[model samples]
Target chain A: MFRLILVAALACVITSKDVLAQEVRITPDTASFSVEVNGKLITIERNQDTNHKITNEFTKTSRPCPPFCIHPISAAPGVTTVGELEVIDFIETSVAKGNGLLIDSRLPEWFAKGTIPGAVNVPFATLEPSNPYRDQILQALGGVQSGAGWSFAAARDLTLFCNGPWCDQSPRAIRNLVDAGYPADKIRYYRGGMQLWLLLGLTVESPNA
Target chain B: MYRIVVLIAGFLIAVSGMLFLQGGQRDPADFALAEDIVIEDVAQMSARTSQAPATDLSGLTSAVRASLSPETVAAPEEADDMAAMTSGVLAGLGAPAPAPGGDDAMQQATAAVLASLNGATAPTNPAPQSLEAIISQSMQAGESDAYIDALLNEAVTSGSVQVPEALMTVDGRVDTRTLIAAIVQQSMGSADAAEIQAIAAEANAGTTPRAPAVQEVAGERLYTVEQGDSLAYIALIFYKDSGQFERIFEANRDVIASPDKIRVGQQLRIPG
Candidate 1:
């Protein structure tokens, strides 16, 4: 009787797996993932509909080039440029573990439009030396202040992304971070950013939500 | 017969008066309008931030302009008047336009304006969690009317939001046309002149601007290893990334035979 029951359970599991195959996934090996954002559980997944075409403002192929110029794969020396899968891994491993941050380094209005799940709004402008709260932000990022300079003994690994390859906000942010003595090796740039993230039908979340 | 003659005479006199009124002197009081003229420059600067009726007016003007062909375009004077009206409507918004310049300049201007707009609340919050935030979030999530209605309903039921009776129809439905104005007014927190005055106010009631105070400590840096100190910790203190411990280990080969072995109170030179 126990053998018969085991066989039946195995059949049931197989049928369920077959049903799940019809849905979209983060990758072939991964279906959906959840991240803890601001103490809330947000599930990040691709749109299930295969026919889902992007109709938003991000669909425009042409943007005026002076500001929206395409950026290279490399952000700067020692800063590792990453893709969407790595970003997911970073969010899960570092951000979920509280050892890292995914910085959406765009202006607040742009950030308000939409962003990656588990990301925090740290506008690129605020990271500059001009902003009065720059040190406070540094401190919040685990920089210890002494008379000499900031000690990043416990600094979080930050992965920054903006509005994709055409967007320079993240690159500008990476430069500023390096200028402020943030380790380039610790900083990762998601060059694909929002544009590619959306193009691939990956999830986009709002900070307010 | 006398009545007919009188009516004809009255008609002729009225025609003469109409012609006279076109080019003759008139009372200035006849053309009186509101004294507190909202500056078009202020309106233009505010631009997209306002949800006032003026925004719709401006939107309509632009829409009209967009829909019309150049051949069918209105007179230049009429177009100018429309532009002026659009500018006037724009003043009701809270945004401050940046000086015209290159792309970087424009982006910086946007950043500056956003920073100032956000300053109305706690300095720590990057964006205001107002009705606009709700709509923005909704747009990001799903811009369907049903979704927005559900969101607004949730907000109302949660008691964090209060829609005025004027904003509601007899059946308690939100009036979509006036809702934009309500959102803007809620975010602004007060009437028009008060907002303009607040912006015009001599930049007080904010933190005094200060230059970047980061003193350059870039000379040949040195550190005294404390108890339980490792090359990694020292590297972290100096370079902000513990992965760079190798740089230190390579530099201090004479003092320490191995990268792992660092005794307490050992002096080491940290490279800049």
Candidate 2:
């Protein structure tokens, strides 16, 4: 899988036919990147069709506020806000290397429709302390069980996102994690979530499908 | 002497069953009573068969006798009805469901008894269903094209169902698509109509009022759009990979909302 990723990364280095016509680059230097996800080679590149605008339900702009209100640029004191590139970079590095998970904090139904490729769904509700399986999930994320709560001394890095900047699912998830004594610095908040990712025409996969 | 007595009993039971069915068909009151009577007969026969371990005929025999019980007397009537209607439609649909062991012994026994009694005892086959009737019914039932294809093959060979002259390929094989189209004449059996129109309006819905228009480009492998031309079918024609239809759809998304809605006579780019 690693070799496949390396080969894909090399393949992307070669100029594409579209690039010769009109280049759309992820960064000044890099055109695309590849990562191995569940033994499948997931090559993350912007959609080549410039005219391809998403036709899915994610196009809603005027959702009523309390749930869809614009979130803070920063969720908490130590939680860092990351963009699509940072999220992509984190996926290629931390997630692929098994040191972290890029989490889709939306509910499972929303996650089923389409998600940022290489993201794993851990819905915000499941992270609440009220859930009996909360500690089990924390343990899965490399948290050690202590007598009273949990020890995040070895907690895995988690980058969480939901529907977009207006969505609070990820923020609530972060709060849940922080309340359970998970280290805030270990959690990275991707404020763009799915909407901006689709707007930019980055690859979205139906992992649940 | 024992054999003669059993045969005599069988004939009497069959005659009574015919009378009951004729009467039941006349009176609407007997229909629900008939179903209940059939259920009770199955229960008794099922218990008898489990104890006896004899042939399904033995269970069927007892069930026929049990049908004459004061309450139901509907088993033999049901059997008489089953004998009269043995078309592939009812042969496939009308039987009681079979249950595995530990679920319901009566259900299994009922299905077994019916299977034995229902099959045409002699080689003299009844007139088969008409081709149009078979195709429309099977399609309405949501059976696969392959299933309908197989059924058509059997019907055509047996000289029962004739594939219409128009649906016959140049090589003389039945084209199931065109055949289904003959039944659903409006949208040519395209799924796009089913997608847009309300399900209640589905049978005669031609939601796409415009005829499929094709754009021909020079120096391309041009294929004319026939009725029922889907992107997947076109991809199969060009690349032999139906999944590659997505590529054509991406190029043509400006006109159609879905790949399925692609009209006839549009030249698709064959990406090398």
Task: Return the top candidate by TM-score.
Answer: 1
Tens digit of per-residue lDDT, candidate 2, span A1-209: 44544544444443233245345667768788898965667777888764466786566654443335688899887999999889989988888887888888764445556888777766665565544445667776778987876788888898999888987778888988988888999999999888899888888888634
Instruction: Indicate which candidate wins on lDDT.
Output: 1
What lDDT would each prediction earn against the true structure? Answer: 0.60, 0.59
Task: State the TM-score, rounded to 2 decimals, of chain A in model 2.
Answer: 0.87
Q: Could you give candidate 1's per-residue lDDT for residues B25-107 as a string of tens digits?
A: 23444335222233554565477346344335455445334323343244332332233222222221222322222233323
C-alpha displacement of B209 in model 2, angstroms? Answer: 46
The window of 10 residues in a row where model 1 chain A has the poorest summed lDDT is A60-69
Superposed model 1: Cα runs more than 4 Å off: A1-21, B1-272
Report the number of clashing residue pairs per model: 2, 2
List CA RMSD, all candidates: 32.8, 36.9
